[model samples]
Target chain A: MAADLAHLSPLLIVCCVGLGILLLDVFADPKQPKTFIGYVAVVGLLVALAATGWLFATGGVLLTQPYFAVALTLDPFALFGFALILVVAILTTLASVHYLPSQRCEWGEYYSLVVFASLGMMVMVAAADLITMFVGLEIMSVAIYVLAGFKRQSPFAIEAAMKYFFLGAFATGFLLYGLAFVYGATGSTNLNVVAEHFAKNDPGLYGIVIVIMMIVAFGFKIAAVPFHMWTPDVYEGSPSPIAGLMAGGVKTAAFLALARVFLTAFGGADFENLAISWREVFYWLAILTMTVGNILAVVQQNVKRMLAYSSISHAGYILIGIVASRSVDGGAVAGSGLFFYLLAYALSSVGAFAVVSMLGKDGEEDITYGNLAGFAYRHGFAALCMVIFMASLAGIPPTAGFLGKYLVFTDALAATHMNLLPLVLVAVVNSMIGVYYYLKVIVFMYMREPRREFETIRSVPMGIAFGLAALVVVVCGSFPDTTIRWSAKAATGNPSADSAISAASVIDVPAPVATTAK
Target chain B: MEQVIFWILAIGTVASSVAVIVPPMGRNPVHGALSLVVAFFFLAGLYVMLVAHLVAVLQVLIYAGAIVVLFLFVIMLLNIQSEDLGHPRPTISKLIGVIAVGFVSIVLIGFILKDKGMAEPPVGLPSDSTFGTVKTVGNLLYTSYIVPFELTSILLLVAVIGAVIMAKRRL
Candidate 1:
């Protein structure tokens, strides 16, 4: 139907772009330049972004029909994810243009793989069925595995890939096993169907066990404490642009999916009243992940490793937002906080990695804290951009990260009224710890003395991309209203204000069992 | 009879899986590969008990028959001997491994404890008329899961291409 086609247009465009890139790689002369492929991929991503905006403006949910029979809900939530993914994809593609060439490893397949990975990420955040989510997760992960080991001759790259693959597959096993347990309890893989089952049936012990398994599975994807070992090594070994993609794009998608599953599906009065509580699990995880990640980052000499740990810590902060959203009193405010934080974090982190990508020569840079000394003297603009990024990451004032942290703190404070004060205090202490390393980068760039001669690579396209990201960082920080309001509206779940409150309460209590067999 | 068979295979599976991980003094790669095959076979037997007959067959066919053979071929091609096993990695690596395994075990035990009261008799009786036989499974695969089934073929094709690309001497 025309309606279905219109609703699905963004996803269809991304998939088609992936295929087109593949075909282009195959048919194009072998000797043709690699930048051509990169250009085509960028164009595709930009078009996808434009199409997504058009859908947001005019499509009106594609004739207002749900796709995949309620198994996969194509709604404003999915549209939000689609928009974020396209932005991340375009930024990553722009960063990659300079990055791959600098490494002397410019392969056309790299662009195709990036596009495919973006498509996979879209599917993941949009998925409404467990199987669809699993498939999407694997598709994203497999491409990333290859990209991590793109520098095949480097032993570090190979080791990173091996670790990522082994751990990723292991985590996937946990996810599948968890799904099996949920299926056993609910007799269905659809999120709504499972939620309905939990609402009616006692579920009793099975409910607690399945919820724990699901938490562990999602915990691993988001790199929470105890499941975060793969992150540092992979980020360190990967090309800087790909590292940006993983930290910014991949983590955001996983968190979005996690929110959908936990908040929308397994949440509500029935499950909340049961002996087990997911809030407690997230509460403990958020505290530990933030503390451990920031503590470890402080001891790291390598900039890449430090950033990797910083990302893990940020995951913890984001998890706090997710936990707050599930609280009794906190609703759309918490959800919107998470969305804003995701956008802010993605912009700053990708921009930081973009600068790192520029610093490398022939794909090799032993970028220790000492190596970055006096970088500001040579490349003032790039150094200033990096400073802004680090400042934002540290949640300093007059930057998007500061506003993001403020929103999260506000949500946490709201939750504290519902007896979640411990979580809020833990987040506060973690943010304090995060300030140490984020400032460490600044100290190295400005205060420390350079050990060797500094040279800057000037790539016009990459500079433009980084500049745009930096601009958004400042602009969003200055005028946070428009984006904040949009995110709040999306989180409301109902168009009318009074209806929004009722819908929130209705979702707070799990829906009664209604069999789909009819 | 089924319980007896399950106990036997389960014991074998656990023992071989342990052997695969623990390198006996001077244990050969070929021996490790063989142990892996035995473990796979026992897993197939367990699948049979679970009434996933087609999966059981495929487990034996693909894992024991094909994958282990590939492992053996790789070992032979690389000319890796029992004595070629390098020194154990650093103490930190060993500690990390032990901690990871311990964490997994703790989580598993936690889940088992949580679900102890809700354990139920496994569904899908192991009879040709009731549960999926090979023919029935094939029919369902082609009908209901046809899209994924076809996608799996494409995955296999990609894997083949990837293997060739990886092994090739030059592009």
Candidate 2:
């Protein structure tokens, strides 16, 4: 019990703070600016972030209590995810202080919901059991659904919320049924226990079917292609800052959870001997996601929609990292590449969306390319910041995006069993194709003449958020070694991963049987 | 005698469930909802036969007593009309959708038919007579599963907040 408290302090702090904010909203002065409460939420998140760092330094959650660790464990991987999510929340809160009021939707619950959502992501990354993961996912998804529909007056906002809720609920059903199947096959929901069971017994075809179902469910959350029909509409309808939160923080959490599940539970001998391999599924998924995302983005006139498709394409690149991680010699580099790329993508994306929030003409979403004509002439500094983000996104040199793509591609090339060289070549071609659309945004900003006197609104908080994000993107890109090392540490700290490999090598392949049971 | 009772309850449960969804019967949703109560009652009887007394009670208390009343109240409050529901045309897309659903169902049936493990299931049934009693469930939920049990409260709290915020008349 004593050890459980120590392990759970970070989550406890954030959860208490969120509840405290809700109570404060109920009792505090109604006339006060909601932005002050937003600041308080940011402070609370910073405190939680510090606590996470302290916990990571000490050791994993429930390190002394194995029983509690089965439910939730704050390993280095979880701590890294917590930090990324906190950064997203902080940036989002900063930008929202200016955005919510401008949109006439200023409510204290908005900040509280953001805090609650971050708490959800924290729990999700730390969860070690299927039940715990499902609970955390619901907390996060429910909060996000409310945030998406925050602007109730707009039909588009309502539609976005409704569509996201129904589809997200459907995906959750698939995930729960898949978890049920896994439990039926293995007789355990705890990841390590399941892995140990598979190590001893042949999982047969049941394992492959369950894995595919889980992948499809997670595919929707990460906005992978074929499961990505809702991305553009949701991104366009939600407020810009919330859209940023979904694209950056939510994606990071989902990818981390997916990687943890595949690398830990399914990383053993039984899975290796299966008739169907997950690596091949991911290979085609990556190709289709990249090509389709880039092609659709090329013709999008709306900036928000274009960014949405680009986010999908980035998911493709991250999938490449997952594919490479399956190989014996490539797990560490490829895993680290996934995290590094996520951080880079998060920073640049938040910065880009913050700028977009400021570009609104007469306080509506300024999405059309025509609205951005001659933006460089009117606001030179903001335009320069935007250029940095756009260039980084296009994978230009001396930017974090370029280093991220380089690492992931090299990791793919390092795979010994699979012929991943062709995949890398295809990725390179896709990246080349991606440059055309990304540059077009720059062309509109710098080359075209102002349509209507270059009128726009500027908010200090948004500017601050953009500046900080831009600085990090540049610094990380320039000094990549330390960040890469940190990501590698986060990736390699999974305790079960090493043992699972040794267990896989000694197990004999069993013949298929008519009746399968663990 | 026990086997005869089990077969009777199983047939009743299936018939009531079918009554709830077989259309023109389901076209009037109110009638469909009413039939759902009978289905739940019959399902409770099936659970009783399985010796899952706690689940059987919940199936009655929550599904039959509370949920059915809630559904009827919502239907009355909404005041929906049969005329308001548009008659959707069957198009080529609809045909494709039906075919796709048929394919998926056949595949599912194939998987279900292939797995024969459940046919012989008497190796380790719970020996304790009180396995599915309320006391046993309460103890398990509060002990080993305490964290998830508490987390469920938080999920409910979030749902309440979301509903109040989204459905309130004004900010």
Candidate 3:
């Protein structure tokens, strides 16, 4: 019992904090701006982040526990994912302090919703069972649905929320049905049980059904191509800070959950079934997602809409790491490649969206290139930070995103079982195409004269968010060793821990085998 | 006799389900609601035959009782009549949907007929009298399934807060 509680501490802290913010909201006057609530949320998230770090430092002795239910795990992989999510949550809360009031939709529930959404994400990535993952996914997605429409007075925000809600519910149905099929095949919802079942038996046509359903579910969650119809419209319509959360924090959690599911429960090659393997499916998804994302992004006139397409392209890049990791010897190297890219993409994109959040006031926003003409002359500091963000997103040198691409492409090259060479070449072409659009914004900011007078709302907390994100981008780019080593540990993880979970859960299976031995 | 009863319940369930959405009776939302209740009852009868007694009870209690009531309330609040629904039109997507559904149903029937695993009891299942009992369900909820059960409470809380925040007249 004590061990279980110890393992569950981080989730508990975050859940309590979400409730605490709701309780805190009651006493504050509605007429006043809820900046203090934002502070509480930040402090709470920082504490949760520290707890995850502490659990990691102690090596989380979680494997030895007799946690028979096996609903959630606090393995190094989960902790690493949790840490990234918490960082995004903290940065988002800080930026939202002034953004809500400036947009004329200040409300305390926004902070609580953000906290709840983070809690949901943490629950989702840590789950060891399909049911628990679904529950966590709901918690994360519901809060985000509401957050997307926080600007209640604006019709666009409302439309964003409604579109996201209906589509999200549909995708969730796919996930639940997929989980039910897995349960039917194995008679258990536990991931370990599914892994064991697939090891000895061919799931055949049923397996193909399961894999495709999961792809559709996860594809929608991460906004991959063809499933990405809603991304541009939703992002363009939502409050910018919330859009940042959707791009940065939500994508990180969904991608990590996708990784955990594919790598753990469905790891065996026998899962190839008779039709086609999931690896080939994702390979095609990766190519199409990036190519279409880059092409569509080039034509967008709105900054938020452009970033939405950019986010879709980033998902394609990250998918490369996943495909590479499936190869035999690609274990830790490709795994780190996937994890490192998430870190880089999350930081740079959130930072970029934070810059956009400052430009709006009174529920009115227009971030056309014409609107941003002469931005460098007007808001020098913000424009400089924007340049760093744009450069990193374009995968230019001296930024985390460049190294991120380098690791992923090289990792794909190193793996032997599949020919990932052609995939890498296509990704290279996409990356070069990406550079053209990313630089267009930079040129507009620097060279073009100011088209109209504009002022960005400045707050101490948002400034800190910008500086902090910028610092991480520059530092991670220059000295990439620490993050690379850390993320690699998370990717491959310790083998003993995996065996321990099997040993604990397979207690009943040995009895059956003993009977067969007789 | 048992096989005859199973066929009656199965046909009743499907017929009522069709009536709930198809034309003539389906044009009126009120008729659709009542037809849904009949379909739920037939489904519950099917569940009982399968020995899923607890699920049978929930199928009636939750779907037939509470959710249907909520649906009626919403319909009443809207005060919508059949005239307000406008004329139903055949569309390209609707045609594709029906064809897709028919194709999937045929494929599922084929798989079910060929499945060798259906011949015997599942190796992992407990096929005793205690299975699917209320006490057994409660025990699982309190023990093995506790995490999901508790997390559901927070999901509900978030939904309640969201509904209020979204619907309230002023901030």
Candidate 4:
């Protein structure tokens, strides 16, 4: 019980903070700046980050606790994912402090919703059961739906909210049904139980059904190809900061959950079991998602819309790591690389959107490429940051994004069982295509003649967000060893843990093996 | 006798569901919503036949009572004109969508009905047949399923805030 409480403290603190903010917003002086709430939310997230760090330092105490019934695991992988999500939340809260007031929509619920959304993501990364994961996903999705339309007066914002809400609900249905089928096949909702069941039995027809439905559901969440129809419209219509949150924080959580499900539950050394070899499905998805995302991104006129496609392409890149993880030797390497890539992507994306948000003033948003004309001359620092972000996104050297791509591609190449060379080659080609659009933005900012003298709302909090994101990007790029080691440790633990499961349950499966075991 | 009650409830449920969606009933939104309420009530009866007493009660209380009333309120509030509702357009895309969904449903129903080697009942059901009773369900919900149960409260809270923010007269 003590261990459970200790492990659950982070989620508890975050939820309490969220509710506290609601109360504070209800009672605080109306004349006080709403940014105060944002600051409080930041403090709360930082504390949660500290809690995660403390749990990490304590090592196996929290990790070994029997809190699995709560559908959470305080494992290294979850902690790493939680830390990345917290970073996104902290940066988003900082950016929102500057943004919401400018748009006159800085309500208390905004910060609370952001915190609640982070909590949801935390729940997702920590989930060890399907039902828990679904609840977490819904929590994150609901908060984001409201956040997307925070600018209540904008027709576009409302439309984005409605569209995202309806589509997200549909996807949730897919996920829930998939989970139901999985539970039916294994007679358990626990991921460990499913893994154990599959170890002893053939996956049968229900396995394929579960995998397909889950793919559709997660594909929508991460905005993979053919499931990415809502990305551009939703991102374009949402407030820039919230768009950053959706792209950065939400994607990180969803992918981590995806990785957890596929790599832990279905990711076995079973290439011959073609029905459940999700690697093949992911390989094809990787190629299609990258190609479609880059192709669509290149033709977009709006910067936000361009980034939405860019996010989809990033999902494809992460899918490479997943496919590579299918190899027995490469599981840890590829899995860790996936986490590193997400962190790198989150930093660059949040910073880029921070710049986009800065470009708006008096409720007027600059969303188009032309709107960025000669931005270098007008706001040299922000433009310089944009250059760094673009370079990182384009996989330029000495940037985190480049290292991220390098690690994942090499990891894919290192996988012996899976012939991912063709896929990696396609990914490289897609990245080349991706460079064109990211560069287009930089060119507009730097080379093009100055259009209307850009007027932007400059606030201290947003500057802090951009600076922190840029600093992390550059530093992580320069010294990649620490993050690489950490993510690798997180990923490597799964295989050993799975082996432990079978060994431990050998004596415990005497009677049930004949009945429930099937 | 039990089969007779099951067939009556099942038929009523199907009829109301069809009435809820089929065009003329939908032309007046109120009629469609009221038909939905009838569908929900019949579904509750089906649940009762399955001995899911708690679920039957919830179906009545939550779906038939709260949800249907909310739907009626929205319909009345919108006060949408008959013309504003517009005539049903039979486009190729709509037809394709319907056909696709129909085919998928057929496939799913086939899968559900097919015997996949299961000839016995699930093992864990209480022999006393008190499994779906309110007490047993409440115990399970508050014990083993506690995490999702708590999270559901948070979901409702967030939904309330979102609804207020979206629907309130002033920001």
For model 1 the interface RMSD, in Å, equals 8.9
**Residues A179-284 of candidate 4: C-alpha lDDT, one tens digit per residue:** 9888777766767667667666767556667888899999999999889999999998899998999999999999989988887677654323855477888899
Q: Please tell me which model should have the higher TM-score, number 2 or number 4.
A: 4
Task: Flag regions of model 1 displaced more than 4 Å.
Answer: A58-67, A273-276, A327-334, A447-450, A494-518, B23-26, B87-130, B133-171
Q: Highest DockQ: which candidate?
A: 4
- Per-prediction backbone clash count: 0, 0, 0, 0
DockQ of all predictions against the true structure, Cα-based: 0.17, 0.41, 0.40, 0.42
Off by over 4 Å in 3: A63-69, A327-334, A495-518, B19-23, B26-32, B81-109, B119-128
Model 3: colliding residue pairs: none
lDDT of 4 at A216: 93
Candidate 2 regions exceeding 4 Å error are A58-62, A327-334, A360-363, A453-457, A496-518, B1-22, B35-50, B63-73, B122-128
Better structure of 2 and 3 per lDDT? 3
Model 4 vs. true fold: TM: 0.94
Pairs of residues at least 3 apart in sequence or in different chains that clash in candidate 1: none
Residue A442 lDDT (model 3): 90
Cα-based TM-score, every candidate: 0.87, 0.91, 0.93, 0.94
lDDT of 3 by residue, A166-230 (tens): 99999998898788778777666666667666666777655666787899999999998889989
- Superposed model 4: Cα runs more than 4 Å off: A60-70, A269-276, A327-334, A494-518, B1-8, B118-127
Q: Model 4 interface RMSD, in angstroms?
A: 5.2
RMSD of 4: 3.1
Per-residue alpha-carbon lDDT of candidate 2 for residues B1-171, written as tens digits (9 for 90 to 100): 977997888888888787786634426668778888988998999888777899999999999999898898878888777566566567998899789879866875677667677455434446766868999888756644566667777787887788777778688
TM-scores for chain B, in order? 0.86, 0.79, 0.87, 0.89
